[model samples]
Target: MSKHVDLPDLIPVFPLPGALLLPRARMPLHIFEPRYLAMIDDALGTKERLIGMIQPNEVPGKKAGGVHRIGCVGRITQFSETEDGRYMITLTGLSRYRARDEVEGFTPYRRFNVNWDGFDGDMGPTERDTGFDRPKFLDLLGRFFSARELNTDWDTLKEADDELLINSLSMLLDFEPEDKQALLEAPSLSTRRETLVTLIEFALRSDGSGDMMQ
Candidate 1:
């Protein structure tokens, strides 16, 4: 089944070159670039302050901020203009999209023509019995804290629901650009959860930070 939605003609987006937004996750961004400032301006002038969150391929070049194919569209749930004209906005992701074409801009930002006519992706089942040998996903998180010697409240960490747990882990993990892009491009939530588990397991075996494999 496909979940078809009427996307706005002009969606405000912030391009984060290497990061991906899983469905239903909230990404808080600090907007400082001039082009993005123009984007915020354009969005605030319209009814929907929805911005597509996409990642650039590399940095420090003319097209340094060129984006990946897939990205998530998010609504500005919380925002405030800073004293220095920067926008601190929290984006609540609504759906993912594939870039159709690129738009030329005089500013330092890039925009894409998105195709989101039929968005069918869903967060799959998370309660299935895998019957694996390793500890629960929450325990792996605890192991991550201990292995990295980082301090966090384990009780709260353990209490987070599966979606929150996985999304939070994805945001905090040190994943490669392509690996992170793969996670973003995952068709469903269960797949992203599984990928995070695999990443955690790999990190456990390789002394803390290790390469994330697809």
Candidate 2:
């Protein structure tokens, strides 16, 4: 979807730390909770068909950032219902939104008043440093994945466009929730790629400074 979606004032949010959706990327979700199932059902019935993916703070008593102030908005592009009554769906990201306020809702799920002004650049690639050290990034990725004793098809990994690569890695890797959110909130695709590579490099360092204490 090349066109930016008209921002919505309120959206049903799925709060799961470590799960992220970037504009134009697709995130598959399995919905079994009664409230979320209802949320999906309502989305499927609506013309907009959107869901917000946000991370909540894991630290006990940190309610302020518990449900992050920002999130990505995605439209349901595919949907299926299981015999077990769960909903399987794929959300194609539209844009990132900031949660401005929580509005009272009649449904079991909660809704948030969101603002998209901050994410105007999400529609497409913006002017970014195109020469941000791809070789070093790939090299660090090699070391990081190798240390974990994992193998990847370097051929495929090399072919994905930078945005896909950055967002995909940011989602697939075991970065802390805040770290992942940092990647999500990166100012530009270029910055996100740099941040991702730096995070990997830090993780590979023997001293393990990448360890952010929860």
Candidate 3:
């Protein structure tokens, strides 16, 4: 089965570094900055609150650098206005895109013309642990936490479904920017799971591994 959606040529893009959003995951964004606030207004006015969440290849404040080629488009599904003049919005991932051209304009926030050429649409099938090795992964997390005396909600974690379980674990585990990017850019659930395994193993060998894990 194929899943498809029409993608516009001009789309509002938010280039936020160090923030990674996976498919089927809800990312809550607090729009406080003036530029981003303007972005929200534009999106709302058009009734097309579709924004591509991309990361800067370099630091954010150093005059926005080029963004990663691959990014996901999120739609504003939930929003709220706060008393302090900020917007709390939760974006749900819809599809992935490739940046075709960067739009140069007077807008403070960035915008881009994108190409959805190779987007496969649907969130691929859930990957089952091929080695039946979840036990080892579980053990590593437990020991990794005990060694650091870290406080974690084991009960809640155990109750989560596969997608939530992996995503939550990825966020809680100490992964480098590059490692996190790898997970974000992973095209399939199986690949992301593999990356998580490697990260967990690396954390066990590093000093004060908690710092290196998160």
Candidate 4:
């Protein structure tokens, strides 16, 4: 079965730091700001129902804070409105995109002209032949979790496939914004797993200072 949707030349962008959305991964977002609330409303009315999630640059006094070139487009799967006019929505990732151009101030929210050529593979099944050192990684994760007192479901974690484990952990873990972007931009699942392991190790070694993990 093929899952296909029309790829638009232009798309609405949500610039958030440390929020990573990989293809086939679902990310939940809270839309409270007037601009992003408008974004969600527009997406609901559109045929594609897509929104681009990109990381913003680290800089002071910048509007939209400058977004990264690469991003992932996700379809709004579920949404509910609060009495305060805020929206709670879950985005099901469809594909990854690279920004060829950005159009800011065109709307209350941000918009971008995206090219999806490089990440065509993201929509397909991730490679699993390379294998993962699950036990070793799990041991490291155990240490990190113990230090932070974060609970873990050993059964579920052990049963998850490589792609799910790698992508989900990368998104869930509290790495720096740039570190999260690095995981999002990883060329392959294999590399992402490696990067994630390195990040966890680095975080464990840190002394309460936020350092960008490689």
Which ranges of candidate 1 are over 4 A from the true structure?
1-6, 9-12, 58-65, 106-108, 121-135, 208-214
Ranking by TM-score: 4, 2, 3, 1
By TM-score, who's the top model here?
A: 4
For model 4, residues 5-106, the per-residue Cα lDDT tens digits are: 888889999988889999889999988999999899999999889999999885677674677888899999999999989999999988888987777575
* C-alpha lDDT of all candidate models, in order: 0.68, 0.81, 0.73, 0.86
Per-model C-alpha RMSD: 4.4, 3.9, 3.9, 3.5
lDDT of 2 by residue, 1-214 (tens): 2454566698998899789888878999999999999899888888889999999865676655458887898999998889999988999888888997887759898789988876776776533458656666777777778777778888888887777777878888888888899988998888888788778777777545343211
**Residue pairs that clash (backbone atoms under 3 angstroms), model 2:** 57-66
Which residue pairs of candidate 4 clash?
none
Clashes of each: 5, 1, 5, 0
Cα lDDT tens digits for candidate 3, 1-214: 1344355777888887667766667788999999999888888776557878887777567765778887878788898989988999988776677887888887888888988776563345544444435555566678777776788888776766667778666644566767777887776666777788777667767745543322
> Which structure is stronger by lDDT: 1 or 3?
3
Better of 1 and 2 by TM-score: 2
- Residue 118 in model 4: lDDT: 76
Lowest summed lDDT window (length 10), candidate 2: 205-214
TM-score of each: 0.79, 0.88, 0.82, 0.90
Candidate 1 vs candidate 3: which has greater TM-score?
A: 3
Ranking by lDDT: 4, 2, 3, 1
